[model samples]
Target chain A: MSAAPVLCFDLGGTRMRAALLAPDGTRLAAVEAPTPAREGVGAVLDGLCALALRCRDTGVAPQAAGLCAPGPLDAPGGRMLAPPTLLGWRDVPVSALLGERLGLPVLLENDANAAAVGEQLYGAGQGAGSLVFVTVSTGIGGGVIVDGHVLRGRGGLAGEIGHMKIAEHSTDCACGAQGCFEALASGTALGWRAARVMRARKDGTPPPSGRDVIEAARRGERLARRLVAEHGRWLGRGFANLLHLYAPDVLVMGGGLANGFDLLEPAIRAEIARSAMPSYRETPLLSAALGDAAGLVGMAHIVRQSLPDLGRERKLG
Target chain B: MSAAPVLCFDLGGTRMRAALLAPDGTRLAAVEAPTPAREGVGAVLDGLCALALRCRDTGVAPQAAGLCAPGPLDAPGGRMLAPPTLLGWRDVPVSALLGERLGLPVLLENDANAAAVGEQLYGAGQGAGSLVFVTVSTGIGGGVIVDGHVLRGRGGLAGEIGHMKIAEHSTDCACGAQGCFEALASGTALGWRAARVMRARKDGTPPPSGRDVIEAARRGERLARRLVAEHGRWLGRGFANLLHLYAPDVLVMGGGLANGFDLLEPAIRAEIARSAMPSYRETPLLSAALGDAAGLVGMAHIVRQSLPDLGRERKLG
Candidate 1:
């Protein structure tokens, strides 16, 4: 008999998504709800349990669950430690709380790390021995996979590539550091740069969103194109650093900014070619294939791996 | 019965040093010879074998050998791929050639990587689960140890930290890149910067070597002190990047410039504390304990691990 499905959750500050995935990683059912982040930890935990139950009630009883959320988190200990987007939540035992409510084992992972595992196992990075997965959204975030395992360094914080200092001097990051990669190249950074440019042009237009800039560039607006190119150049600089450090089989780009990967690929490639050592220049850079589903799929795999006995019990029954 | 000793070699452009190390990593006997690098691969290989035999003849027989040399190298394939320091040599199968001569199984690793393993297993980084080892010599190079195994990324070039671009604009590196860690922070870079300063002052003093600058700084010369501080600042920036990316248990410093580690430590620590995220700020920065013997000790361990059967055979005999 085939193994039972595993429940997976991608809990973001803005939304909470849950899915029941078949053993082969097919999403059999899913549910979504707005996160009660502003309503405190108790509300958030209760809401997650409700969402998970709604997905579990879809006629396929998941044997285990996995949760992927923003960090700084203790993945091994299953605790959240002050994720920026989730206001006022601190040291919450997310895995334990949700697990007790559902009476199943729940493994926890960083969202970007889940995406990396997802891509490596089922997306653009399939068959790769090692990869670097980067997500450029409100803030740049990433995960590193080495020899098929997520490189969770001391304190499970190994893949904080977004905070890597890319320039000697530049804008400040929310982390209070100057010249961080996220500060220079994230979607938020791109929009802020575009807004500054528009303001300097003495036009009465309101500040554009990151997506607005990408859309403008798609429509052949010269200013937007220039801004996007500059964004790609910063990303290339950061990617070159990643290549030098990891030399992964591939670099998988995801997140909202990656929607403009086609527009950004040329500049990114050109800068990496110019900045990276020749040996590292040939590493493939590709767009992530799993999209929003990556975290869910990755979580499902993590759950199965962590609770193999549950899958065996289901098969035996 | 105790395990047999392993022969180890640290092959550099300037010297070839060989040693017989007891199973516990104690150096039993050693021999050194100048590398005939300019005379080409055949001459260098012959010199290495002669040195190895001399070290072996010192009353203990080694069952296998490990060699740590400058890279770009294919460590698993045991081939050197166009190392900059080794003149006129490319893709030489040094391990196969040496193993054939000595009648022993041989393992090869990049020099920095070997040092990293050595530090992690038996030196300053002893007991650390993960660490980054950096050598500041004529060039900057590094190795990453993740979960007790060296992180040899695609093509075995994972830890080329020296070539990591630290600045968006700066001096040129030998690798044809601008603003690399090596170009900014290596002993060679420090010397070059000092020489430029001296020339601009129109002083008739011949260009100072990197060692000269360090010695001058030791004596509290204001100009040399300032230069060394600048060098430390650059190293700090590069190290902050490493900390953010790897969050290693510790960072071990080695190579020629590390001799001045006491003087440089303050600036290096200041930069990292100022730049790295709070969680990573407490990682201990240490001077390499085994000194020049780190490579040999590391290679000895590698030899034992790679050829466990050899150790068993020696024990049985």
Candidate 2:
């Protein structure tokens, strides 16, 4: 028989995903929904409660919920405070509200922190004593895990690696910082570079998205390849900076770039090998093993570990 | 009488310092000696033993010895694993040897790590929940502190912040990496920049050291002020990377250049203010209160915490 489940939720800008996980982190069932962000907080909360309630049908009542959303959260207060991704989200009492709605205990975690915890507990970061999980997506974000616990910096803003000024970049990032690694090498930056290349093709040529650029590069298109290479180099520089700064045992690369690991791994590895100190050169760079489910899985694991009283909660009849 | 003491020693390439510390981290009697580095391992060990033994006459058999040395240490095994600054030393079983000689246990820590520990305990970092101690001396080094513990990375090499590739640089660092923060902004780099300016001698200007340049800047030398300003800007870039990377509660600047904190702080603050995320903009950057004594005090603090049994040993008999 499968073990009792843990509730997990990941709230993104446009979507909300809820899942049930067995003791060892296997997904029992999952439910997804549009975030209803434009309709305001109450609608979003209602949607989340409905999605979580969907997981109750597997004859398993999760003891506690691990609610992960974009952050700059007041974890002690169980609130999300002004995260940019979710407009109008300020001082959200996420855990408490969800706990009352679901009639279960709740633990709130920053999405990146949850992902790192998940990787440390059940994915590529398993057995790694110290790890840093970096996701190079629409924007760069990360979780710093050391000795099996996520390091929640002073305000839980510790591992914002993408915003680090790793080099001189002419472009400005959405974060109001110029030359951030995110501005130089993130998926958004890749699309920006692709658009620059496509700008001259005024004869009804559509501007390529980040995914289109990656596909073109895979097809060996010269301009796309150049853009991808530049992205890799910038990523390599960012990786080197992370290595020197944290010197984690393993660096797990997540986000969309992980899907194209084959194309970017070489330049990233070469840059780190040649540039980081000798002691940091051997840090294994691995792809995120749990893929898109990392946040859901990680949030569950975090709730299980952090809320030990969860075991005392009722199981669904 | 003061509370029991903690024995402390800081070993450098040029000198060795040993001191006895009261429980509150106040310095009692202290002694200094040449490092005996040229005499190889045996002589160096003997010198350290003699210095530590000097503290014994205080009618106080200290709890345990905290030995600070340049590293990539095997702190668990208590050994130094070939730090570049310390020539011809490798695989030295420091803690065990010192423990055997002193008849008390020993904790061997990287110098920067020890300094960080000391600061967290009693210096500028007092009451700080998390701190990152950065030393910009002949070489750049740093120690990350979180939750009152020094972050000893996977292999005790975690806090090598100087080796970070935070910006572009033309010179090769001692660590074999080009454009490392150390290569771009450290005292050694400052000297390199100063020498280049001095080399275009239409006048018989003597090539100055890094200190000489700083002194000249203080004396209002136009060229010297420019050099210092450039160095400060690079340091600012490195600071911005660190602020984003670690997000520590306090950033303590130490080492020789810290003597000129006035010259560097504004630029560093400006850089971080302009580039770092808004959440990280207010990170408190402070001068290292313990100064040259930081390494000694930090080492002792680390030992006291790491080896609880040391408290069971002699407490100033």
Best-performing candidate as measured by DockQ: 1
* DockQ for each model: 0.76, 0.68
TM-score of chain B of each: 0.95, 0.92
lDDT of every predicted structure (CA atoms): 0.89, 0.81
Model 2: CA > 4 A from native = A1-4, A37-39, A57-59, A96-105, A198-204, A220-223, A308-317, B1-4, B96-104, B198-203, B220-223, B308-317
Accuracy of chain B in candidate 2 (TM-score): 0.92
**Interface RMSD after interface superposition, each candidate:** 0.8, 1.3
Worst 10 residues of 2 chain B by lDDT: B308-317
Across residues B1-317, which tens digit of lDDT does each residue of candidate 2 receive? 22458888898888899999887777786899988887788788899889977877777778667888887778777799887766678888888777788887787888988888878887899899899999888888899998877787687778788888866556888887777888888888888898887787546677677788888888898998889988888888888788777789999988889887887777788877777777788989898998889898877666666555554544532
Which residue runs of candidate 1 sit more than 4 Å off their true CA positions?
A308-317, B308-317
Clashing pairs in 1: none
Model 1, residue B137: distance off in Å is 1.0
Q: Write the per-residue lDDT of candidate 2 for residues A1-317, one digit (tens) a residue.
A: 22558888898877899999988788999989888887778888899888877888788777677788876787656899877777788888887788888887777888888888788888998899889999877888889988877887787778878788776655878888777888887888888887886786555667776777888889998888878877788888888888777778999988887777778888788877778767787899999998778899988877767664454543431
Query: How accurate locally is residue A103 in candidate 1, as Cα lDDT from 0 to 100?
Result: 79
